[model samples]
Target: MTSTPDVIRGIVGVYHADGGLRGELAYLIGKARGTAHCGLCDVTHHALGRRREWRELVAALGVPVELVHLNERSPAVRAASEGRTPCVLAVTDAGHRPLLGPDELAEVDGDVARFATALRGAADRAGLRWAPDER
Candidate 1:
């Protein structure tokens, strides 16, 4: 794993829900006892090539990025998802912002230029520096 930037002020983390055995169990539990959990991180488990794309894109901004497994029970992730998974969240000094969903990203159709523009906008909205050195 690449190291977190020394001047870190934010994280562009992606949270993915599970769609496997654990997911089924979580569903049943949530139905019964009202809780949840995830089996895997979708972006890491699938999207083989796009993982590199996501990494390269985040790397350029000089901020930490993480691919984390998310389930409905995780309050922060749940609040971030707001009903969906594979959500990109900008957790910054100012606050948290749910930037995109996997489906929204797919709409960009592998266009890094478009993705970067959106990311920069999110950074600005979250009061984070796209160029950490400038901060």
Candidate 2:
């Protein structure tokens, strides 16, 4: 049987513009019952954990990542379905596309190393920052 962590690493799903992913993350954490907490750090940790789990699963299972948009589909969707991991959907007035930040692009060039690099690059490009857990 697959462990919880292993199961977490194999899920692939779509994120809608209406904050579906965030909502799903919250739901997942909430389902943990006593394990869930009201503290900010706790919430953030849970969310990040979910995100990491999703990413790992997509990578391990070769699952496609997709983004929802009006009319046309995002290139990232195509790339993801084509077996690209760590793909991003950038919503734009023109349309969405599969995009990688410098780090993500760099990571794609190699193997597993690309995951961290791409994540860092994507965070940098998105003006977001991630810190390791205190534990």
Candidate 3:
């Protein structure tokens, strides 16, 4: 295995739900019925909309963070995220790597602070370092 740290240039998050209006509606209904759950969603959003904590976390990360639904994910993301919904990917010059999986995300339980901590830990474990700010 490559032990050298990869310079993380960006981050990608894949939600468990599909994209588009119908998919969103279905996810909402399923969520209401307790049949569908996305830990990433819980961390990033609330009933009112995107959480302030999430925005702050993103800003502090000093990297581009892109969140996408199931249908919105690229083929590469789909492959890395296959069978693993609600996950986070680390983007590096080496390519994308799985940074956090569903179970890890679920552990955060809607807390942005916890998620940030988890992300930092995961990145370290994965031999990743955030890219230096261009500014």
lDDT of 1 by residue, 52-95 (tens): 65557666766666655554334665676666665577665444
Q: What alpha-carbon RMSD in Å does predicted model 2 have with respect to the real structure?
A: 16.7
- Tell me, by lDDT, which candidate is best: 3
Each prediction's TM-score against the native?
0.54, 0.25, 0.95
Summarize candidate 2's per-residue lDDT along 1-135 as a digit string, tens digits: 322211111112222212356654664566476443222122112433544543463444332334332223345454442443323443322233334523344334424344445544554565433222222
Clashing pairs in 2: 9-57, 76-98, 104-118, 107-114
lDDT scores for all predictions?
A: 0.53, 0.36, 0.92
Candidate 3 per-residue C-alpha lDDT over 1-135 given as tens digits, one digit per residue, 9 for 90 to 100: 443348998999999999899999999999999999999999999999999999999998999999999999899889889999899999887778998899999999999999999999999998889888754
Order of quality (TM-score): 3, 1, 2
The residue ranges of model 3 lying beyond 4 angstroms of the native Cα positions read 1-5
Q: What is the lDDT of residue 50 in candidate 1?
A: 47
Residue 32, candidate 3: alpha-carbon lDDT: 96
